[model samples]
Target: MTGEPILEVRDLCVDYGLGDRAVRAITDASLTLHRGEVLGLAGESGSGKSTLAYALTRLLRAPGVITGGEVRFHGRDGSLDLLAADAAALRRVRWNQISVVFQSAMHALDPVARIDAQLTDALRAHRSGLTAEQRTGRAVELLRLVGIDADRLRSYPHELSGGMRQRVMIAMALALDPEIVVMDEPTTALDVVTQREILTELMRLKDELGFAVVFITHDLSLLVELADTIAIMYAGRLVERGPARELFEGPRHPYTVGLLDSFPALHGERVRMEGIPGSPPALTALPTGCSFHPRCPFALERCAVDFPPTATPAGGSAVRLAACWLHEGGRELPAPLARSLGSTL
Candidate 1:
């Protein structure tokens, strides 16, 4: 998972409109995703996590526009700027270099089409060199790979269960041997048992295939366990990004901490989860200064007036970066945030 990065996104800004009426969904977000690694993107419901994913794959529609920055995708052939990639360029990389497993299983699959056809569609499009027999054989193998019965390939989307469809989607994502799979809440609607099973299979597949995963979820504890690096977004901006162990052991940003508090631990004492207090601000009319300041426990007057820059201090702080006044101007965090952010164990 080391060496050169497979994907480098620099200051990617996605906005919905113009002038004062504009609403930013993803702002100045940058990250490098290496191969054979899982980079988890976590945030609240309206934190633009999904929007960022859509923009990365050129899936954003209508008013949702990628206004600034660059998305550089590095592959074996060379580097391709995704931001500048046209429809034809995107077509080349769609399922081959990169793929996505959407959150809603039902919405993604075609109800009228048979399970085998739906699963083989991407392969048929991207790997058109394959004959019909070859594609069909691959589809059957894919079903088995995802733990579904190959015999069920003839069944329609309505025939399979929720978990089954999700697995089908995963199999499809891996069909073209994609280097990166951007999964957008892949197990959202499934039961806990099903979710765990899917995650286990996904990890197994990743290990076998040697491809990287961009797992997007609002669940912090899940991300902490599954991802090597975690990126926290708040109101269209990345408030924190660091190694999962460092970010979860003691969060640097208030929003990240709030998200952690919201998820119940899978192990240890199963205590009731606390909500993040106020609902996320409307994307159309976002707050001034720090978006999380309204709900922050250690908010200062300056927090409401100016935006904070991301700064990584020396020492073993998990490469912590927080876009809050507490960490701005190379200043030490306030006593409370420091005490909380610097928690031992």
Candidate 2:
């Protein structure tokens, strides 16, 4: 259901500070988002999911810097280099072209402002042509679009439930009819039922509005159901990316296999689950070679001495890519990985 490429991130890097003390937060992470596609970014916390989203949208705060690479946004009018764009150009593009819904609704929303005021603020800024009344009307319409009643428009953020506040944020993101929306763990705090409702509403809205989405979350299972393409990150690098179904069914990377095995299957019979052992490497003191080699059970000798290049795994789809030695030069997959992937690979 995706169209032509809308956003392309190539070899993007991000650092937390300046000079020799800077911590590398994201490194050479690249992905393409087609129009109307839901590209899910999944990883453990601090794997650079939110950092990448912020960097792509040029929303990274002070002390956080884009060290290298390009972010190209292809809009209807023309292609724009987001990394190189100036403040004025970025202002024009943000909200109007790309919007973001932060992880916490309580923190993202203005505590003192009414939902109506919060929603209309974006319209007032980006949509100057609209009158006050018109902005309010549009806000009401947006609230309704997100399944929020117009009557609650006057309610403050604290007055609404967690889900309602999140929906309001989503409504605000869609107010400008942006081409893309970056959602950073928008449902993390909500109950399972509320999470399902919000996600369902989000997907429905995406279909109706034709907007691309970069959904950042730690939940691979949820992404499996919602995202068209899924990108997996580890130690600030994109280790795997492919069509959602393919990545889930035939994960080629050992780290990916570990992640899948960590989660209990819903339909299958009960079985023992062994999650990834050890912790992610600290950004400041990452291992010399493959960052994950210490924790990878199927790592080769070279994996401890040299970083593996991104390569297409044997029997994987053409678009699939995994940064692991197991898939290099048509080498046979490890027994554990093959068993985990079943006959899919």
Candidate 3:
């Protein structure tokens, strides 16, 4: 069950360079993550999902900067503007308040360090008052919590299996007991069976630990099962967002419908799948109006000239929002689009 809002991101924008040459990576993205809610950010590669995650945590590298907007973290003490926070303040908040489980465990973990040393490093940095023995005990307990045995504490990253290394990364993220955990494709590169196991363990741990999650992936089918709320992105902007089931069953945006059709149905009878036409537009020279109009099968005349405003689509849930001309002025969606969605709108 989700509680009050814990993190609020408003009109966030990110750019890759300075001045006129800069390419906008994220534009006016906004979303709220409630305490203990699973918020999934889904889009294809280069859709800015990872960029958004990195920006939220103030982990963006040089040349990639937050040009506008606010990211507020509401903690037990008080609310904090993460973008405006100083380096010292960010350090204090990073591991203790919000931690990240990066995409690749091999790249994330120190190759030379033992699992125990890697796990205890955060405790040493953040919980300095703890003695060395106490930190070691916490490391062992964290490993056990992730289903790893204490015997593996002395093993290096190369010594562990792919699944085990990923578990170790998760254990480190939970070591500080953060209020929020940002997982950027945490299950990537693993086999199908291992992916399911990791996802199951993650959900179970979330229930036990009570931390909100920001799960980033390109897999909409996966998000429908794992996320409470799903936000769809295209070319850097959020195109649609709603309850996961609603968004999957009755998507209001053409891009979303296209994505759903691209994936095979896991349970239903086998059917022909169609991929979205054309590639995403370059961020430097985005088309006028809706960025997705070039590939939208149901694009309107206005879609070519005027950007669609974000609005609640007709026949959609009150909490759902989509940015498309078809949904403007409470107009019913076109017949072909409605047929594609397999729902009345």
Candidate 4:
């Protein structure tokens, strides 16, 4: 295994249109994921969590274009630039070097094709050296690995339950033994029971395989259990990043604090979870200075007019840094922010 990161995304930006009024779906978002680590990108809708994941896959749809960034993949074949990968290179790299478990696994599969064919497509595309017999054996092994019956591989997608179909998607993702896997709301469409069960299975697989994971979800609590590091995004920008414990234990940014509040814990008193005021701002017309200031309860004049420089300790990285005014002046986060972050959990 390379000592370098399995996936390194730097200064990545994705935009729509060609001019000043164009919307920036993601802006200067950067993160590094090492093998066996899970980096959770958490936020509300429009936080650009899903957009960034799709960007790494080079699967950006129309009205979504990558404006800047380098997605570097370090793998057995060698390091490759995802942003610059051509059709052939992308084919070789995708599924083979890295794979994505899309949110809607049932939808991601071909409705017209049998499950076996879907899994075989990836195996054939990446591991074509395998004979028909070899591919069939491997396909069944994969189905069993994801906890699905091997016979289900011959069935059509419509024949399986939602959770079973999701398992098949994961099985297909693992077909080539990719070093990194990106999961976008992996259990969104399932019931709570199924979601928990699926997550349990995913965690087990994660520990056993040692592959890195970029887990994109709106649920902060879920991330706490799954992620090694967590980055919170707001209005297309990363507001804060840190080890999961540090970020949850002491969230510096008001937005981060609000997110924690929004999800009241089952164990805690029924404190009112105040949702952040107003919807996310239009990307084409972003608020000046701090993008989160307009909705921030702790916002000050400087916060609205001047962007906060990143603050850090002498050694750095003890707590992942953030561009928030609250962290300045060697002060602790405000009482409300602290209470919001800690009242539960």
Scored by TM-score, the top model is 2
lDDT (10s digit) by residue, model 2, range 1-345 = 899999999999999999989999998988999999999999888899999999999999989999999999998768999999999999989999899999999999999888899999989998899999999999999999999999998898999999999999999999999999999999988999999999999999999999999999998989988999999999999999999988888887888888878888877578888899999999999987789999999888888888888877777778989888876766677875555433432
lDDT of 3 at 101: 98
Error of 2 at 80 (Å): 0.7
User: For model 2, what is the alpha-carbon lDDT of residue 147?
Assistant: 97
Name the best candidate (by lDDT): 3
Question: What's the TM-score of every candidate structure?
Answer: 0.93, 0.97, 0.96, 0.93
Candidate 1, number of clashes:
0
Q: Which stretches in model 1 have alpha-carbon errors above 4 Å?
A: 18-20, 266-274, 313-318, 328-336, 339-345
Model 4, residue pairs in steric clash: none
Between prediction 1 and prediction 3, which has the larger TM-score? 3
Q: Model 3, range 14-109, lDDT digits (tens) per residue? A: 999999889999999999999999999998888999999999899999899899999999987689999999999999999899999999998999
Please report how far candidate 2 places residue 345 from its true position, in Å. Answer: 13
Taking the tens digit of each residue's C-alpha lDDT, what string does model 4 give over 19-82?
A: 8767888888888888888899999988899999999889888878899988898888888999
Candidate 1 per-residue lDDT, tens place, 162-254, comes to 999999999989998989999999999899999999999999999998899999998887887799889998889988888888787767777
